[model samples]
Target: MKDKKIERPIFPKKAIITAGMPYGNKDLHFGHVGGVFVHADTFARFLRDRIGNENVIFVSGTDCYGSPISASYLKLVEEGKYEGSIEEYVREYHEKQKEVLEKYEMSMNLYAASALDRAGEIHKGVSEEIFNKLYDNGYLAKASSPQFYDPDFKVFLNGRQVVGKCPIEGCSSDKGYADECDLGHQYMPDELIDPKSILSGKTPELRKVTNWYFKLEEYNNTLAERVDYLRANSNLRKNLLNTIEESLKPPVIFVKRKQLEGITDLEEKLPKHRTIDEPKKPSITFVFESLEDRDIARGVFDEVGVRFRTGKTLVPFRLSGNVEWGIPVPDKEELKALTFWVWPESLWAPISFTKTYLETIGKNPDQWTEWWHSEDSKVYQFIGEDNVYFYGIAEMAMFMALEGIKAGDKIDWDKINLPHLIANSHLLFMNKKASSSGAVKPPMARELLEYYTPEQLRMHFLSLGLSKGSVSFMPQVFMEEKDKQGPDTVLKDGNLLTNVFNRLVRSCFYTAQKHFNGTIPVGEISDSIMEESKEAILTYERHMYNHEFHSLIYVLDSYIRNMNKYWVNNMRVADTSDDNALRKQVLIDAFHAVRTVTTLIHPIAPKSCEKVREYLNVNENLWNWEYIFEPVYKFIVDQTMHKLKFLEPRVDFFEKHQSQISF
Candidate 1:
C-alpha cells in the first residue's frame, strides 16, 4: 500500500499583512518596490483569493514624522528650493508615494500616513495608549543619558542629524547615526566614533538628557527563547534569525592590545569580566556576564584612555527623544516636553492604519482587535533584512510586554500570536547596493514603467529570489555599457508570461473557434492532466506558505510550459488524423489546464488573467479558489448555451509594450 499523503498547509481564518513604510522625505526608489512591496502585495493578493477577500487586511503607510523628513525639509528651505512649510513638504512626497504605489497596482486596502489627516489623529491616540500601557506595566523608565548636542548651533540633534562610524563589532555599514547604525544595531549615543553634527559640520558634545526608554535588556532571556522557538517551529528567514542571535550575545568590548598595555592591574580596577588574550591577535576582548558589568568596565576603560568598540547586543530601547518634529510624548513626572522617538512610534503605525481603514468602512475602530488580537488571526510583517533587529526583536518584546508579560516571564507564543516576519535580502542595483545618499544612485520605482508594462515588471521582481539572497536588478535599458541590440536579461522570466503562456491561451481560444463553434466542448479530462494540475497546485501552495516566492515562480514556469507543450503535441495529432473525438478530448484537457493556470497566476499578473476571463465569457467567480479544481464549464450557468466571446484576428491576451516591437 502507498503511504498516506501529507495534509495541505493551513491558513489563518483572519490575517493582517503589512509592507514596511517608506519615509515621506523622497519618492520611492526601486528597492522599495522590487525588494519589499511587490512581494508583499503578491502574497496579500493570494491571501485574498485563498481565503475570503473580506478576511485579509493589507496595509502600509508613509513614515511621516522621522528626522530624515525634517532634515530634508530644512535643507530644501535653506537652499531656496521651496517656500512651503514642513507639513506641506511631507504631504507633497506622501501624495507622490501614493501615486507610485497605484502605478505599480499594489493592492493595499489602505495606504495611510502617520501625520496626515484622519490617520494622523488616530496614530496619535494609538501612540499615547501604547505609552501609557508600557508605563503602567513597568516596562518604561526615565533614564538621564547623554545625547548628542551641537554647541555650534546651540541645539540638540536628532539621530539622523548626527553622522559617525558605527562602533559595533564587525559592522560594515556605510552610515551610522547617534544610537543605532544603518544596519540596525543598538548602542549608546556615546559609543559612536568620530561624531559630527550634520547641522553645524562640527564635532558635537554629549549632554545629559532625560528620555523614556523601554527596558529591552530586561527581556534578554525571553527574546532568546522566542528566537529559539522561531528557529525550531516557524518559517522565519535564516539571515534574520542570525541577526537576532547576534544581538542576543552577551555584552563584550574589544580593545587594541597596545591601548590596554598602558593600564597596569586593569582587572583589579574594572568590574568582573572574562578576558580573552590571544598572542596572534592585535585586539584583546573583555566579555561580561551582564550589561551592568559591561558599562562599569567601559567607564574604567574611559578613565585609562583605553579605546574600545562594543559588540552587538540589546540595549535600552529608547521610546522618546527631544526632537520637536515628532509626536509629543506624554508628560510623565520629570520626563516632560519630550517626543516619541520615530522608530518606536512607526512600529505601531500599521495598527493605526488598520483602525483608520475600518472607520472609513463605517465599522467600529476597536473592531481591529478581531484581526490583531485573536488566536485565529495572524499578522505578517514584510520588511528588509536591515530591519530584523527592530521588527524581530524589539517589536516582539514590546508586544509581549503589552500583553502583561513581565520582563523575565516566559511568553506563550500561541497566546500572544506575535507577528510573523518575512524579511527579504537586499535588492542590489548594477551589482552594488544603491541608496539615495550613496554614490551609486538608484532609479526611482516609477522610472521603470517607461520601459515595460507594470505586469512585466511585477513578474520579474517576484522571480528575483530575494527571499534567499541579494539579487541585482540589471535592466538592459539602464546599463551604462551595453550593446544597442542585445538580449535583455531582465525580460527572461517575464517572457514565460508574455510569449509562452500568452501563446497557450490564444491556442485554446482559436482552436475552440475553428472546430467547436467558439464553445467550450464538454468531455472528460484525462487522469494524467488532472494529477499534474494537482501536483502543481500542492507545490505552489507549499512554497507560498513558506514564503519561498522565487521557488513558487519556478513551479509556475514548469507547469505553464508543460501545459503549452501538451496543447501543441496533442492538437497536431487530432488535426492530422481527422478524429473529432480526439480533438474534443484535447480541447477539454487543455481548457482545464488553462483555467487552472489562469487562477494560479491571477495574483501575480491580474490584469492579463482578467482579460483571459473576459474572452472565456466567464463571470468573476472564475477566480474563486473554491472552484479552482473544477472545470471551466462548472462556472457556466448553462453549459450547452455557453459560447465564448469572439476572438479577433491577431489578438494577444498577454501583450508586450508597443515600444518592444521593432516593426
Candidate 2:
C-alpha cells in the first residue's frame, strides 16, 4: 500500500456520450430526464474529469420531424389549440426541452434540433452522406412495400397514423403502429392486427409504395456475429444484450392451434420449414431459414385464411417515407420524392450534432472522426428500455453497414467502431407503466422541479437501480392524501448530502478555525484512513466502468456516514482528555476522506461539489485523478500560507430545497 501497487481502471482517451432525443411534438416527460439524461450526464461529467474535459462531447437534440410530429400538429391545429406553422410549433417545444435540460444541469456540450436552423442544415448533409455511403457499399435497397392508405382521406398514412394490435408474438405492447410498436417491436406492415387509420377512424387498405430500405434482414448472420463480438468485448447491460439477441433470430410465424385445427394439409401447402408443435402450448411455431421463404409461407397462410403472428426478428429497415415534415432523403435511383424516416435519420443525428458543436467552437467539422472512428475513442449511448431495439440493434447494424461491413465480411476489432449502448429499464410512475399516449400519463420533467431541487431529483434518480430493473418514481409529494403518510422515499438518498455530509464538512471547517486559527495542520493521513480511502476510490471506479450507478450511491453512503461517525466518536474522547495531538490527527484523516468523497461525488452532484472545492481554498488540481489518493497537503502548494475558508454558523453548502425547509 505504501508504494501504490493497485491497478486502476482505464478510461477511453476520448469519448462521446449521447442520450436519446426527445421528439419535438411534446415536452419532455419524467422518464426522459430521470431514466436516461441524468444517468448520461453523470458518466459524461465523470469522463470530463477522469480525462480532460475537452476530450468528452455529450450531445442530443429534439427529434424535430417525423409522422408523430405531423400527426400531433394537425390534431392541434384542427382543434384550435395551436395557431402556428409546423416549424414554429416544433421550435416552441425544442426551446422548452432545452430549458428543462439546462435547469437540471445536464452538462451537454450541445443540444441542437434535428430540423431547426443551422443544426438542421448540418443534419441534412449528414443524412445524405450516410445514405450515399450505404448506397455505394451495396447495402441500400429500393423496395415496394405495402403501406397503409386511408381511402377516406385520399392519402397514404405515415407509420404513427395507423394504430392496431402488435403482430409480434409474445409482445404485450399497448398499441402498435404501421411497422413498429410503441415498445419498439418491429414487424411487417401487412402483419399488423386489425389496422385502422387514425386519420379516418376506419380500416385502411394496403397500397404498394416504393421507398429505400437498408438490407437489414439479409444481415441477420452478420448481426449475429456482432452480438458475439459484443458479448466477448463489452460489459453491456444484460437486458440490452438479450434484447439484441432476440432480434437476431431467423424469420418465424406462429399460428394458434385452435385456428389450424383439422387443417391436415397446412404443412404441405406452405413453403419448406421446421415446426415446433408443443401440445401444451396454445400456438405452433414455424421457423424459416430466410426471409424469402417466410414471405412465400406468409402468402400461402393468407390464401388458406389462417391467422398468424410474426416473432421478433430483423426485417428490412425502411429508410424513407413520404412524410414531408422530415429531412429529405437523398434522391437516389430516380426516387426523388421520399423523405428519411424518423427512426433511421435520428440514428445519425448524434453525428450531425457533433459536427455542429465542433463548428460552433471554431474546430473543423471533420474532426468528428477522431471522436467517432478512432481506436482511442468510445461512444456511449444512453436510452430507455423501450428503445433498445432501435438504439441497440438497428443503429448498430446501420453503423457497421456504413463502414462497408456486410454479411460474411470479417470484423477487425481494431478497425470497426461501434457504440456501447446503455439502455435502462422503464422508470415507472407509481409502479405503473406511463406514457403520454397511455391511460396513466407521465408527469412532465419540469413538473417535479416544483417540489424538489434539481440536485435532489438527480441524486434520487441515480439511486433508483434502473440498471437492474424497472423502478418506480413514487415521490410522496405526488401520492394521494391518504397515502402520503410515510417518510418520503424520494428524500432518503438526498439527505446524505443535505444532512449527514453537510454536517461533517461544516464540523471539519469549524473545528479547524477554532482550534488551529483556520490553518489545518500539515501531516500524513492516518494509515487506517488512507487504506479505507483507496478502497473506496477503486470500488467507485469499477462501478463506473460497468455503469452500475446505483452501487456508486451505496459506496458514497457508507464512506460519508463512516467519516461522520469517526469524527463524532473520536472528537468526544479527544475533548474529554484535552488531547490536541489526537484531535489534529483526527482532523487530518477526516479532511482526506472529505477530499476523496467530494471528488467521487462530483459527477452526480456537480454544483454542490464545486462549492465544496471553493471553501477548501484549493485549485482544480483537487479533482485530478493523478492526486486522487493524495492527502490534502498535496493540493496546497504552500501549506503554511493556506487557510481554509471559515464556515459561517449554520450555513449549509448542500441545502435542501426551499419547499423541504421548515420554519
Candidate 3:
C-alpha cells in the first residue's frame, strides 16, 4: 500500500509579526537577538514569501516609559556618567538599539520607540484610544491600592526604584521590583517581602494610590476558552500553555500552620474559601472561587496577624501608574495625574508602530485595522518564556475586553483575530541564564559580529531549538583558554552553510563555467532528484509552519549534503569519460538542486542567498512561493540563448569572517 501524502499548513492571507520590545534604557543584549528577534524576523520573511510582501508587517520598538529607564537614568546622573536629560538618555539608547538590530540583519519594517519622534506621538494617541475603549466597554476599574513610598526620600517609588524579595509562592527570581519580578511574576506592592527603596537605601512604606486597572479576573473563563482553542488547533509551546494555565487557576493564599493555630476563628472571619491542611506541609492553603474573595480573605488574614503569601493567579491588570516619564494618562473625571504603565502601553506600541509605518509609506494610517482586526489577518508575537503571562494572558484578555466581549459572552474567534504567541525558552550563556541586571553579564548583540558573520550567527541562533528548551550559546571567542582551541559548538550548524553548502554551490557554478561556457547546461533533471527536492521542500514548509525551526535546519543539512555527494559521485564518471551529454546531464541536475536549496534557505541567510540569486541572474520572483517548487529551467526566459554570469575564482556565496576562518 502507498503512504498517504502529508498536507501543507495553511497560512493567513495577511500577517503582522512583532518581536517583544526591548527596554530603551540600554543597547540590546544577545538574548534579545538570539532568543526572540531572529526568530520573529525569519518568520516574517517566510510569510512575505508564502503570502505577499504587501500583506505582511513586521514591527517592534523600544519600551521607553518604564520606571526601569527612569531609575537607570537617575543612577547615571548621580554617578556623573551621563549629563543628558532622561529623554535624551532613552533616545540615545533607542538609536543605538536600532543600529545594533540592523547590524544583526533584523529586517523590521519600523523599529520605532514609544518615547521618540513621531512614533511617540502616535503611541500616546494609541494609548488613549485603547484606554477609552476599555473604559467604554466597562472593562476598566479605578482601584485604590498601596504603592511603595520611601519616607526618607519623600517620594513614591515605582518599579525598579524599589527592590525586594519576591513574595510570590515558589518563585525563585533573584530580583523583585515594586510590582513584578525579574522573572515576570506579578504581585501586589504590599505583598513584596523586605522592600527597600533604591533612592534612599531604606525600607519603604505602603501609601494609598489610585490607578486604573483592567478587570482581568473577569475574563478568566474567556481566556480559558481561548487557551483551549489554541491547544487544540495551534502549535503553541507546551511550557507557554502550562504557564498560562497556572495563571488561570483559582486564587490561593498560603499561611504557615502555626499562624492558622493562633487564629482559631479565621474560618468564621474570612470570606468563603476551602482550607487544604496537609500534615506533611508547613503551610495551610486557602483557595477562593474569585479574586475578590481572595483579596477579602487576605485582608482578614492581615488583620488576624497571619503571615501569608499569594499564589500565581489572575489579578487586576494595572494600566496606569504615577511614573512621570511615561505617556500621560488621559484625564478621566477626578482620575488625574497618572501615566500609562509600561507593560500595558508597550502591549499596544506595535499598533502605533504599524500606523507610523503605514503613514510613512504614503498609505492610510487606518489601514492598520485591516491587518489587526480582520478575520483574514493574523498576528504572530515572538516573545521570551518569562513573558508568556503578560503576552499570552493579560494581553489577550485586554484585547477581547476592549471589543466588548464580556466574561460569559460567546466568543467568535474568527472575528476577534487575537494574537498567536510564539514563546521561546531562555538562551543561556555558558549554561547559565544571563541578563544585564543579573550576576553573569550577557554579551551585547553587536559584540558578536566581531568574531562571526551575521549570517553565521543567524544560522546558529535559528538552530538552537529554543522553542523546546533552554539552549546555551557557547562562542569560543568568549571561552577560557582551555576551551578555545577546538571547534565552537555554536558554529556547527553555521558550518552547514559556510562550508558544506558553500562548496556545493561553488562546485556547480565553477563546473558550469569550466565545461558549458558559463551557461546552465540544458537537459532533463532526473526523477530521483526531483522527488528528493520535493520531499525536502514539503518537509521544510511543514516545519516552518509549525515553528519547528531546528527540525527545518536538519532537513536542509541532510538535503544539501546529499546533493553535494550526488554531484561528486556523478561528476567523476563524466570527467573521466569526457562525455559531453553526461556532463550536461550532471550540470542540469546539480544546478536544479542548487536553485531549490538556495530558495529554501533564503529566509534564514537572506544576504548570502540573494548573492546566489545575483550570480544566477534571477529576479526577486525567484523567492515567491508560487514558483518555489518549479525547476530552474522554468525560470529561464530563453533556454537556448540564456547566458549565466561568470563565476570568479574563490568567490563564496556564503563566507565566514576573516577571524573565524583562522579558528
What is the per-residue lDDT of model 3 for residues 1-663, given as tens digits with 9 covering 90 to 100?
016567778999999999999998888999999999999999999999899898899999989888889888888899999998888998998999999999888889999989989999988999999998888878889999999888887889988888889988999988899888988888889888989898888998899999999999888888888888878877877778888988888899998888767456778988888989899999989999988899898889888777889998888999999988999998896999899999999888899999999999999999998999888999999999999878988898888787677888987665677888899999999999998987999999999989888888888999999989999999989998887767787788889999998998999888888887888877778888988998999899999998889999999999999998998898899899998788788888888899999888988899999999888876788888989878787777777777778889989889988886654
lDDT per prediction? 0.89, 0.90, 0.88
Give the worst 10-residue stretch by lDDT in candidate 1. 1-10
Ranking by TM-score: 2, 1, 3
User: In model 3, what is the error at residue 473, expressed in angstroms?
Assistant: 0.8
TM-score of each: 0.97, 0.98, 0.97
lDDT of 1: 0.89
Worst 10 residues of 2 by lDDT: 406-415
Candidate 3 residue spans exceeding 4 A from truth: 1-4, 258-263
After superposition, the stretches of candidate 1 with alpha carbons farther than 4 Å from their true spots are 1-4, 278-281, 481-486
Candidate 2 wrongly placed segments (more than 4 Å): 1-6
What is the Cα-based lDDT of residue 67 in candidate 1?
78
Q: lDDT (0-100) at residue 470 of candidate 1?
A: 93
Error of 1 at 296 (Å): 1.7
Output the better candidate (2/3) by TM-score.
2
Clashing pairs in 1: none
Per-model clash counts, in order, read 0, 0, 0
Give the Å shift of residue 521 in candidate 3: 1.2
